[model samples]
Target chain A: MNKRDIALIIIILIIAVLSYCIMNISSDKDGDMVLVTVDGKSYGTYKLHEDREFEIQNEYGYNIISIHDGEVCIKDADCPDKYCVKQGKISKNNESIICLPHKLVIETVRTMDDGGAGDIDSVAK
Target chain B: MSKHVAKLGIFIALAMIFSYIEVLIPFSFGIPGVKLGIANIVVVTGLYILKPQEVFVISVLRILLMGFLFGNMLTLVYSLAGGILSFVVMLVFKKITLFSIIGVSAAGGVFHNFGQILMAAFILHNEKIMYYFPVLLVAGVITGILIGFLSDNIIKALKHYN
Candidate 1:
């Protein structure tokens, strides 16, 4: 490892720390937990009544997301590209399900006063 | 009409096939953009089998086609950057490390993702984009290792078979 290599290493370390912090911070919860479901299977859970909850699913190599409730996950997906999954929960606020390879995403968001899913609505349009 | 031309054609086809096959399998990596990068194996193989110019051709075609078939056209720029960067890095690393095909392929894979992320950060111009670099790097490392390991065995098997 030369000086260049060393510099690259430091940069990567910083990125890892930053990525961890961002994911953790956004994954935070400050209200009642929401039971996010898809096709009746419990993929994951988040705390935020209707308006503030988010959930994702990795079903058979395809990722799906549920914004406020279980009503929506990625409409279409395959392993080819999960751009939609990466898109995350893009609400008008900043949430959406992205399927990267598939190039599909639901960039729709909802407002939250309590940051809970209790007020979340479903518009899988 | 020409032996070299036939070989180059064969390599291109093989790379495309590998890329398609890799696209089908689902990776367990929770993070997005993680995969075997199997098509990269062909790119590495081309470097070994053909001249540098031919290798470059294969690399560009592989990435461009993969994007066109599986990705949005808007992503073409990122794909081009990644493929070119990896090709260049592999060319340089070849002189320094002189490792086997697998080693070279590994290096190429890491370079590929690093280049892509770099382009993404540039286009987005959001410092926040920097946060994803580390995770992408780590994933790139693991994928590179896998691609390298597989290609190594392939060379070994082919050498003996021939």
Candidate 2:
């Protein structure tokens, strides 16, 4: 409605679009489980079968990570805010999920082959 | 003396009603503990209508009452952190930002989440949990927009309603 409004709108719109590109993203085939290795440890694994759900806990609380229909996500969490759980689902297009509180991320990448969307690696099952 | 008591009663009632609304809105994002926190609108209203100390008193009372009614003692920590942080953030925004009430309210939403998360990490002693910062920040961005957008429209309408 005014100049300030327009500026804020522009900033928000940019952020929204930039962020949209990161949602519903999936990873390449890493067998039945896509292991996101952060630092020296395996942060967690995404079980690629009919969109499974799991939880991983760090210092903060339990993070409910859900993978469904070939996508992965943080489904529920014990963290105070639960923002990661609220992020909805993510797929290959988005390719990764990150929760700041958990210092965790679930990303998609083929350890063997690159099949286009919907190609489920037999080993990844 | 009786009139003062009546005002307090009305304020408490309004807060309870708003808290109920906060729990009922259906915006589940498939993540645990995610909510729009709409009930905060009442606290924001208190901030504007009552003195800061009065607002503090009301906030403590509301959180305690709501916790007793619907939440556990553990959960009260997060609520208290969120409420107090929101007040601080809103107070700062009010001083410097030209944003409308909606914007101020949205900032409060983000602050509330931030405070809650900070407390969680502190209590748990897990600095790694801070990684959720970006994700929550993103959520805060979205929820802030949502609260701000709604409050903006409401603020515009409040003039005529009052």
Candidate 3:
């Protein structure tokens, strides 16, 4: 490795640090709702405190989502990778568990009345 | 020309073997889109021995064949995006001549992750996927450096063949 290679490594590390900090800071607020999207469309929005299980079956595949104690996770999935299930649970605003093979996304979102500024009003609209 | 074609075939086969080996290892970091990228060893080595276009072809062919044999359609899309993006970035860095093979490979590694994440965001229609970027970035650099180091030594040993 030469001087330029060292510099390149340093630059990449800096970018990683900056992005991590930004993502953490922006997601400081706890989410109050879980928004599920399938194939770029809204599947459903459930309150985080509800403690429920949601089953999603579609053309792509199947996934079972469970929300409990204000944290959301994919309890089960038929996708090959299972990365979403492995992602564990997310409680912070904007946190997500994505099933890429099924084109499914389960995101933690803050509702408008919950003091999350500038968020869309509802998934229904 | 025939000799070059024959060499390209060998490199492509080498890359595919690397891909197969990677699949056999069951390597996982729990996070999606993170891997050792073992196949990159061949592509990085090709940068010094073959034309940029030839290296690109080998990389593309490797992704396609691996996807068909072991992966699905969705994986094929993700691999194509990451493979193409990294190849372009590596070619540009190599042309600059300021960085060594390790640096070029490192850049390729980081861009490969970035490209895959970007594609994920687009397909999922949510920018929240960007949250995975930082972890993937670090993983990319580390794996890229390892692959680059291996490529550097391979290039050195192959110098005698010229």
**Which candidate model has the greater lDDT, 1 or 3?**
3
Whole-model Cα lDDT per candidate? Answer: 0.59, 0.62, 0.88
How do the residues B1-162 of candidate 1 rate in per-residue lDDT, one tens digit apiece?
597788778887888888777667665587766666677887776676557888899889877877788766647788788889999988887767545555566567777888887776555432334445667777766677677667667766778745
Candidate 2 regions with alpha-carbon error over 4 angstroms: A1-125, B1-5, B24-26, B149-162
**What are the candidates' individual DockQ scores?**
0.13, 0.10, 0.83
Scored by TM against the true chain B, the candidates give 0.87, 0.81, 0.96
- Writing each residue's lDDT as its tens digit, candidate 3 over B44-116 gives 9998988888888899999999999999988898899999999999999999899999899999999999999
Docking class for model 1 is incorrect
lDDT of 2: 0.62
Top candidate on DockQ is 3
Residue-level lDDT of model 2, residues B11-100, one tens digit each, is 777777778777776566554555777666666665555566766677778888999998766688878998899888877766676766
RMSD in Å for all candidates:
9.0, 8.0, 1.9
- Share of native interface contacts recovered by each model: 0.19, 0.08, 0.87
Q: Which ten residues in a row have the lowest lDDT in candidate 3 chain B?
A: B24-33
Candidate order by decreasing DockQ: 3, 1, 2
- Cα lDDT of model 1 by residue, A1-125, tens digit: 24544344455556667767765554343323333333323345443335442334344354444445422344445655545534443323323343333322333334356544444643211
Models 1 onward score TM values of 0.61, 0.57, 0.95
